[model samples]
Each structure stands twice: as C-alpha cells, then as structure tokens.
Target: MDSFLSALKISLWVATSSTLLVALFGLALAFVLARCNFRGKNIIDAVVTIPMVLPPTVVGYYLMVLLGREGIVGAPLYQLTGWSFLFTWQGAVIAAFIVSLPLMVRVARSAIESVDEDLIRVSYSLGKSKWETFVHVILPLARSGIMAGVVLAFARGLGEFGATLMIAGNIPGRTSTLSLSIYSAFQAGDDTRAGQLAWVLTGISVFVVYLAGKLSRSRWM
Candidate 1:
C-alpha cells in the first residue's frame, strides 16, 4: 500500500513537470513552424517527430549516450559539478518529456495552421504587431487544439515506461513511477498490487481523454 502511494506520487510529479515543459516549448515550436519559413525548417520538424516513431528503448539509449557521465554533454558537466541524471527522478522527467513532446507539437501545429489567415491579416492591418496579433488572435483561436495537445501530453507522460525504465531504472522510492512499479509488482507475483496500479492508470487516462474531448468541443471566448 505504501509503495503504491509512493509510485503514484512520483508518477504525478513527473507527469506534471513534463507536461508544463511540453506545453511551453511545444506551443512555441508549433507557432514557429506554422507561421515561419526558413532554411532547415523541415529538418527541425522531422527531428522533433522522430521520438514518436522511434522505439522508446532507442530514445532512451540516445539519451544515455548524451547524458552519461562519460558522454559528450555529460562528461563536461560531470567534471565541473559531479552531478548526473542517471537513476534519478529527473531522468524520468526527461524521458517522459521526449516521448510526449511530438504529440503536443503535431496537434498544436495543426491547430495553429487551421486559424484563418484573413483574421491574422486583419489583426495586422489594425496596427497590431506580429507578437500582439499572436497573443490576442492566434492563441484564442487555437486554444482548443492546444489544450487537447496538453491533455494528451500529460497522459503520455503519466504512462511512459520504456524510456523511463532504461534511463531511470526501477529504484523503489526514488525513480520508480507507477508504470515501473506495476512491472515490478507483476515480476514479484503481486498480481493484486499490479491490478490496483493498472486500474489507477486506466482511470486517470480516461479522465484525461474526457477532459480533452470537452475542451476540444467548447470555446472559452
């Protein structure tokens, strides 16, 4: 019971943190991709989408290569501060963020693109700067889609398993999320515990999807 609660707590924390990041960066990238054209734009879009298609283990392996103590990015940081992401909850957050980011970007980009160009042009003709127009016009118009993306991203983060297992490992009371805990319980022949955890995950996922549908159908303004 105690372990179940702990795993639930960790899962919520990781999912919330990763979802906030996904919302922020995903909206920005979506806006940029929808509104701007430049060299290597397609390359950037493809790179962002890669995680969604690649196996989670492959994604985790790539993260390990980049963030391991002896790795290119990790080596310099480790030498300076002796800190590492390996086997930490923070590493789980990173894993969730990477796996869920593409969903946010894709949905939000489609939303932004669907906004009427005439409305944008009218905003511009009314003496609004591009930033002002985006703030006032584009965001409100795209709110439903963006909110749906956020909900999906949160659900994805909450359920992330493979990359999280590879990077964060399954250290009880530390990096073990609900998904990892479920796996551990099953491995230990604790069928009841695993069932309880699975039920909790299923309930949360259903609520998130319901909320997404509601947001997508209703307009705030």
Candidate 2:
C-alpha cells in the first residue's frame, strides 16, 4: 500500500510538472510554427514529430546518449555543478516531457492555425502589436484546442514508461512512477499489485482522454 501510494504521488508530480513545461514551451513553438515560414521549418517540425512515431525504447536510447554521465550535455553540467539527472525523478520528468511534447505542439499548432486571419489582421489594423494580438486575440480564440492539448500531454506523461525506466530506473519512493511500479510488480510476480496499478492508471487515462475530447469540441469564442 505504501509503495502504491508513493508511485501514485510520484506519477502525478512528474506528469503535472512535465505538462506545465509542455504547455509553456509547446504553445510558444506552436505559435512560431503556425505564424512563421522560414528555411528548415519543415525539418524542425519533422524533428519534433519524430518522437511520437518512434518506439519508446528508441527515444530512451537517444535520451541516454544525451544525458548519461559522459554524454555531451551531461558531462559539462556534471563537471560544473556535480549534478546529474540519472536515476532521478528529474530524469523521469525529462523523459515524459520529450515524449509528450509532440502531442502538445501538434494540437496547439492546429488550434492557432485555425484562428481567423481576418481577426488577426483587424487586431494589427488597430495598431495592436504582434505580442498583444497573440495574448489577447489569438489565445482566447484558441483556448479550447490549447487546453485539449494540455490534457493530452498530461495523459501521455502519466503513462510514460520505457524512456523513464531507462533514464530514471525504478527506485521506490524516488523515481518509481505508477507505470514503472506496474512493471516492477509484474516482474516480481506480484500479479495482484500489477493489476491494481494498471486499473488505476487506466481510469486516469480514460478520464483525461474524455476531457480532452470534450475540450476539442468546445468553443468559448
């Protein structure tokens, strides 16, 4: 019971944190992609989208190469601050953020793109700056879709398993999230525990999906 609770807590924390990051950066990236056309834009979009289609293990491998102690990014950071994300909850958050980012970006981009260009032009005609137009007009118009993207990203983060396991390992009360806990229990032949955890995760995922669908169909403006 304690382990279950710990896993639940960790999973929620990781998912929430990753989702917040996804919402901020994903929205910005989506806006840029929607409003701008630059050289290599397609390449950037493809890179962002690739993780969604790649196997989770492959993504994990990529993360490991980039974040391992001797890795290009990790080595310099470790030498400077003596901090590493390996075998830590922070690592889990990174894994979740990367894997879930595409969902947020894709959905938010579509939403921003769907906003009426006439409305944007009118805002500009009124001497509104691009920043002001985005904050006031664009965001309000795209609220529903952006919210849907957030929900989906949270769901994806909550269920992240392979990449998290590879980077964070399964340290109880530390990095062991619900999905990782399920894997641990099953590996230990604890069918009962695994089933319970699975059901809990399934229920949460179902609720998130339903909410996202509802938000996608809703329009406040």
Candidate 3:
C-alpha cells in the first residue's frame, strides 16, 4: 500500500509539472510557428517533433548527452550551480516534458492555424496590437485544441517509461514512478503487484481520455 501510494505521488508530481511546463512553452512555440516563416523554420519544426517519432531509449540517450555530467551543457551548468538532474525527480520531469512536448505543440499549432484569419485581420484593423489581438482573438478560438493538447501531454507524461528510466533510475520513493514501479514489480516476479499497478494506471488513463473528450465536445457544442 505504501509503495503504491509513493508511486502514485511521484507520478502525479512529475506528470503535473511536465504538463504545465509543456503547455506554457508549447503554446508559445505553436503561436510562433503558426504566424511566422523564418529561415530554417522547417528544420526547427523537425527537431521539435523528433522525439515523438524516435525510440524512447534514443531520446534518453540524447538527453543524457546534453544533461549528463560529462555533457557540454550539463558540465558547465552543474559546475556553476551545483545542480544535477540525473537520477532525480527533476530528471523524471524533464524526460516526461521532452516526450510529450511535440503533442502539445502540434495540436496547439493546428488550432491556432485554424483560427479565422478574417478575425485576426479585423482585430488588427481596430488598432489592436498583435499581442492584444492574439490574447483576445486567437486564444479564445483555439482554447479547445489547446486544452486537448494539454490533456494529451499530461497523459503522455504519466505513461513515460524508457526515457524516464534512463535519466532517473528506479529509486523507490524518489523516482520510481508508476510506470517504473510496474516494470520493477514484474521483473521481481511480483505479478500480483504489477497487475494491480497496471490496472490502476489503465483506469487513470481512461478517466483522463474521457475527460478530454468531454472537454472537446463541450467546447464545440
């Protein structure tokens, strides 16, 4: 019971933090991609979407290269701040964020692109600043897709395993999330515990997906 609760707590913490982080930054990036056409935009878009298609282990490897102690970025940052994400809850969050970010960006970008250009033009003609127009015009119209993407990102974060395990080792009560815990339980021949956790995870996923469908339908209705 205690183990189950701890796994649940860690999963919720990592999922929630990753979801929030992805949503904020993802939406902003979506807006940029939707409205702008800078040089190498396609390359930037491709890079952002790579994790969605890449194997989890590959993504983990890339993350380790950039964030590990010997990594170029990680080496300097750790030396300067004495902070390291490896094998920590923050590492789990980073893993979740990277894997789920593409969903948020793609969905939000589609929504923003679908917004009626006429409305945007009208807003600009009214002397509204571009930022003001976006806040008042684009956001309201795209809220449903943004919300759906947020839900999807959260769900993706909750189910993350391979990348998370790479960065944050299975440390019970610290980084052993529900997905990791399930793997550990099965590996130890604790089939009963593994089954129980799997069912619980499945139920949560169903609930979130159902809630997302409702939110989407309500927005359209």
On TM-score, the candidate that comes out on top is: 2
For model 1, the stretches where C-alpha displacement exceeds 4 angstroms are none
TM for candidate 3 is 0.97
Give the lDDT of residue 110 in candidate 3.
Answer: 91
lDDT of 3 by residue, 36-137 (tens): 999998998998899999999999999899998878788898999998889999999999999999999998999899999999999999999999999999
Q: Least accurate stretch of 10 residues (summed lDDT) in model 2?
A: 68-77
Candidate 3 regions off by >4 Å?
A: none
Q: Estimate the TM-score of every prediction.
A: 0.98, 0.98, 0.97
lDDT of 1 by residue, 75-147 (tens): 8888999898889999999999999999999999998998999999999999999999999999999999999
Candidate 1 to truth, TM: 0.98
**1-221: candidate 2 lDDT, tens digit per residue:** 89889999999999999999999999999999999999999999999999899999899888888998888798888899999989999999999999999999999999999999999999999999999999999999999999999999999999999999988999999999999989999999999999999999999999999999999999987
Higher-scoring candidate on lDDT, 1 or 2: 2
Assess the local accuracy of residue 174 in candidate 3 as a C-alpha lDDT between 0 and 100.
98
Provide the overall lDDT of each model, using Cα atoms, as 2-decimal numbers. 0.93, 0.96, 0.93
> Model 2, stretches more than 4 Å misplaced?
none
Q: TM-score for model 2? A: 0.98
Task: Give RMSD to native, each candidate.
Answer: 0.9, 0.7, 1.2
| Candidate 2 displacement at residue 27 in angstroms | 0.3
